[model samples]
Target: MPSAAARPWRARWRIEASPVQVLAALLVLAFLLAFLVVPVGRVFVVAFTGAEGGFTLVHFGDFFRTSLFIESFWNSLYVAAMSVVVASLIAVPLAVILARHRFPGAALITTLGVLPLVMPPFVGAVAMQLVFGRNGTVNLLLMDWFGFRIPLMEGLNGVIFVQALHYFPFILMNLTASLSNIDVAMEEAGQNLGAKGFTLLRTIVLPLALPGYLAGASLVFVKVFDDLATPLLLNVTNMLAPQAYLRVTSVGLGDPMGYVISVILVVVSVIAMAGAALILRGRDFATQQRGGGGLARRPLSPLGKALAWSFVIPVLLLVLAPHVGILLLSLATVWSFSPLPDGFTLAHYATVLRETPQFLTNTLLYCGLAGAIDVVIGVVIAWLVLRTKLPGRKLLDLMAMSALAVPGLVLGIGILRTYFDVKMPDGASLATSWIMLTIVYAVRRLPYALRAATAALQQVHRSLEEAAENLGAGKTTTLTRIVVPLMAGGLAAAFVTSFATAAVELSATLVLATRDVDAPLSYGIYVFMQSAAGRGPGAALGVIAVLTVAVCTYAAHRIAERERSRRMREGRATA
Candidate 1:
């Protein structure tokens, strides 16, 4: 330790003395804005500028005055708000129960709850259609068994229903994490002081969990609001995402009006991000964290047991129903007015494989590139924030997190505005190019990898790194030999997640893809669903996307599990 006399000038010896660190920092910040911020800002510029480069508010005027656009914007907000409220109501109690108690298949249940997140939104849309559409499974069973039917899938209601089912898990997962950190000792004290049941919950549990609950709510709200594919797939024509797509594709407005809508979505997202920052201000979650321990379980009374089982069964069904429907549809030979398919076959998959090799190759290449780019930039950004004393460290953190709010459609449009017309000296252009897609995917997925890397770095103590340096290891050697190996699991997790998300990215890909190459599975599904014999092929492609994501997510989970087990074994051996 430095003496008091030398303390003021004795710096922390930040990990930034070398050219490598400086270069990495500069590359990361440039890449981040190039893909994330600059393109986003371009939306505003394109929206307000004339063809001759003059400025006007005609785009905004058109957006507000047009009946279709105004209605869609309002509808999008309405659906998002309602979905958040309903999902939160269901998720909060379920999260509390899961966090506070243990039961059979607890791990499986938790995984199942989060499974929807890995599946693409379009898959959810297809699945919900099979389960809840007119003459769908639910209606068919009811009509056949009891001569009764219920209208379940139509209009905004259908969109909200599916969204709520798919996103409730998001709220539940976040809430579970939040609630698990609440101190049980406080509840124990209250109980010992004559507080019981509802009273104890209201005064002790609820107050402590409010911040987390709100955080979950905010996350779910933003997720629901920003989602475009789900609403489109569910046939909600009057939604902002589809509306923006129409403006760019159908209305022949090019990107000016599209940019206006994208700007609005971005503004809304910024508000949500601000709310999250305010909720979490100055709170060190790691320090305040508590374990979900010491809660004793007792056999429930008969009726109580019945109620518990009832709740569990329906939630399980709700979560599983869409997936089951999609899987069945993917394999179905035909499904017109049939309770079940008349036959099952792999014909759809075969047809797609034979007819569209480009889809497979394009998706793999783009997703792979995007995933690689995301991991590299994410690691660099994490290092800059954690290992180096960058000038704008806090601002970088905020910017990274803030990307979560920018809708994918909005981001895609931003990319178009920024690089569509830029020419290279050799006559190559950036617009709709493979490199551009990779960059967009990288920047859009950066937050996930950055967050993962940051967390992973935190786990491997800095002292070990410093010790390596003191023992004659160079900075690069120390990082490569010690830090990278230690954080391999987290990096792999981030890579797999980024890959899965990129594979299924629709809104952004739609903007970037051309007929020749770069059109991914999501874009293909969207195109096929518009043709005759399209539903089957679309469902088939949806299954493929879902399976791809599932495989990657599963790989990530397995890697994480293996690493955790190894660490525990090593700890035991050391002890």
Candidate 2:
């Protein structure tokens, strides 16, 4: 009925998925649907449902009518916005200096800049209070010398200060990488056209790096917006995230206010992500061409060097304050309203190791499983989206990444509401099990692993796979022998990224941890920080958490470097 050309085109339009591809797609879809879509959808349904079980907007209306809810909503918005601004101010100058200039100790500065990320913002809240609180060291000194104290850790200001310091690394890392990729020719062209110094940077360099800046900014905004632990630690419960947590825990799940707050969080997250995308749409900033080099690094003059070091020294000290404070607190016998500790000892570490070693054991078990699940799922999703022609493959990728927009607190609530009634064979509800927490960690961190896997897969060029197939290898065989081996470094990195981040996760764990024995290090730290006697143990636990994350991050970096070096050697041999 059709010509030869038409027949070929029609065949191309039909589904080209292999049986293995189809099966993998279905399994991934089922997992996401069960754990992610269904749970989140359940929250939406409860938020919109009335007392009579009919669809209505009464809960939302009530939310708007309440003055407290209105205040909480605005408070969250203000904090998120101010955090972005402060984080930007800190990150931008640092990123530009590191990316656009060559200076002494540059590598060391870069490493120190990212040290903040190893410690969670919530953990840092405690140390911040110790360093900047009303009765803390800085204030004590200020009263003694300057006769005035700065309210750096007062109320909302404390949350902003801790969040900005801990999260600015996101913007710094992204912007620095983006800036490193820009073509030198663009800057030269601007300079040739009479643009110089600040003018060239503002008009050309900054605009080119905008996509990266926006990416990091949006992440900061979403992270700060849905953060539950930091605000709670600061005793600031007037924000949306804290309110949602309180309403759910204090008022029970059946109370619609928690669901309402969750829905609002999800909406705001989606909007922030969408707004970044909209701003970036239809704008192309690609400047690099084959054989072209990155932006030219300028050497700073003597005065310029002095100015750079002056800025760098203070920022480094500020960023590292939490680590210093926590370490000191852990060893301190008494450290209130003093510029120095009264005494130092190792009793807190000994206490944690002797009494609550299960916290560390539980973290390893939970986050290890979560990291493994993420890498496996991430690889499957990456293969499906990139290699297969299965219908809804892109949709599967989107769904996996959509976890970014779902707040950890919201996900915890959704999982509780959706699965609490579904009993296991052991008679315990699935939502109450430790396995569910593992799944939540996996789901929340899947986006990071997926991106890592996708990048790894992309690096293993199609030609290598094609050559394997041409030599009589089947799809599965080729993947196992050629593709996966090549992607081993990236997969390891992905696992570590997921594992490290999950190790410190507090929002979802706060909701799901039902017992002390079952809880992880994060929950232990939180419990210990609730009283004066426990602050020592809490700070000790915080140090352990930081060490765990730092180790994993270092390992990932080394693995990636080794893989890159191996590839370079292979390329040279081939040439």
Candidate 3:
């Protein structure tokens, strides 16, 4: 439909890729097709196919007819919805306090708010049981004083409590970013129209941040819905993810119910994502413009500050309870039927270090390899999409990002079902091999690395690469010598992000790790926590996992900050 003049202009923009570029793209596509697409497709195929290999809905019918499956489906929906509500309640006030008000220890509070995220929700579930369960420290004190107790960690309530505490940072981070970017002019305009305080916030501030809130809320819903370890750890199996896990593990992989549940999880995730997109359609929430600033932070009055502290301190304590409980548990020699530990020692840590050093080594090896694979694939995909003229480049990006919708448990099931029979030359099935865990980790964490790589590539001006081309540099040379060096910081950060997250990943690890020696720290923690005697070492392992993730997170931040500062300095120098 373009005119002749426009045709040439468009053609000029589309540069033909070199043979090397073509090959790279093909390799990446093959990897995704084999590992990501085929496995998930196999799950759908199996779910729909009857034992006679004919298309049928019997599996789905069986799923619906079963009372337990029905209860699990509803329980998952209820827990996910309630978790969003509770997480929103916790995150919104804190986001407002941090973004809209100036107060002492605000930075510290903000830092502590994100602490829960570094610890996995499953790990925290046990710690929470110690602190808030019926026989827990708080309940013990309550019964002694008032002769009554609250069922905070009983059944589904425990899952919700642990998940809300662990995952609220998603809402907090997104809403805080949204609130900080809101233009102050809107608030002033609302004040001019006789709106004040909560009225102004209700009318202007909250609506402007709805996009971010919805984004976070949808993420929380999907995560809670897809979570496998948390509910299982809490001894609550009447949930979709846990049921899928249980069926696959206990009932054997041949059962169609697991795949059916996986299909439902995939559907719910897709619907939740699509619903959020639908709600946000055609609505522009962009308030900041050039030279504009965020909402002005007002200094808190003494009474206002006191009220804020009273709210924030308790929330922080409650959120941080898992970390505290885990630490005390790791040190406690005997901590039962009491408010505090009877005694403390370092024997548990010593025992973990002496007995299960393989968990640490396996975590390092698997996560390291996965991170490397992610960065390489991410860079290639970013280049093909942004720089080269490749067909279906956007599709490649979409396929990689689609992993976000695939729950780890679902992915694990798919991987097992798809590859359980495919034996390697070593005479072992590919599904049970440790390499499969690494591959799954790479697939699960690809989206983050791809976004990082794309952002990094975008920041490098094309003129620099063009100059290299002008000087007889080929695409390969230019990328290796110029593009990659510039992107080193971002790529390193991407690797760290991938490594840290993959270290704590348990859903796929649960499905793929068939033996004790091949399992990572996450599975080791799960194994240890199943009995009371192993709780000490499990808590110690949990602490180590938390520390590992925290350090990696800090390193990534520092790398990003240093790179940003360098870029700023370069801009100033050029100017």
lDDT (Cα atoms) of all candidates against the true structure: 0.77, 0.93, 0.94
Can you rank all candidates by lDDT, best first?
3, 2, 1
**Residue-wise C-alpha lDDT for candidate 1, range 1-575, written one tens digit per residue:** 66887765555444434777777667777777778888887888888888788998887888889998899889988988888887877787677667776555667778888877767767787778778788888888998999987776788878787888877887797778766776667677889999997698787776666676777777777777777787777768798777777677676436577778878877877787578788778864432325645333434567755666678778888888877887787788887677888889888888788887678788888888888877776766677678876666657766776678788888887777677778656565675776777677777787898888888888888998999999999877887899888889899999998888888888787777766455778888888776547777777888888888889989998988987898799889979
Taking the tens digit of each residue's C-alpha lDDT, what string does model 2 give over 265-372? 999999999999999999999996547688889899999999998999999999889999999999999998799899999999999999999999999999999999
For TM-score, the strongest prediction is 3
Give the TM-score comparing model 3 with the true structure, all chains together. 0.97
Q: After superposition, how far is residue 453 of candidate 2 from its true place, in Å?
A: 1.5
For residues 116-173, what per-residue lDDT tens digits would candidate 3 score against the true structure?
9899889999999999999999999999999999999999999888888888999999
Using TM-score as the measure, what is the rank order of every candidate, best first?
A: 3, 2, 1
Q: Listing every candidate in turn, what is its Cα RMSD in Å to the true structure after a full C-alpha superposition?
A: 4.2, 2.3, 2.8
Q: Alpha carbon lDDT of residue 230, candidate 3? A: 95
Per-prediction TM-score to the true structure, in the order listed: 0.89, 0.96, 0.97
Stretches of candidate 2 exceeding 4 Å from the true structure: 1-14, 288-291, 467-472
Per-residue error at 311 for model 2, in Å?
1.3
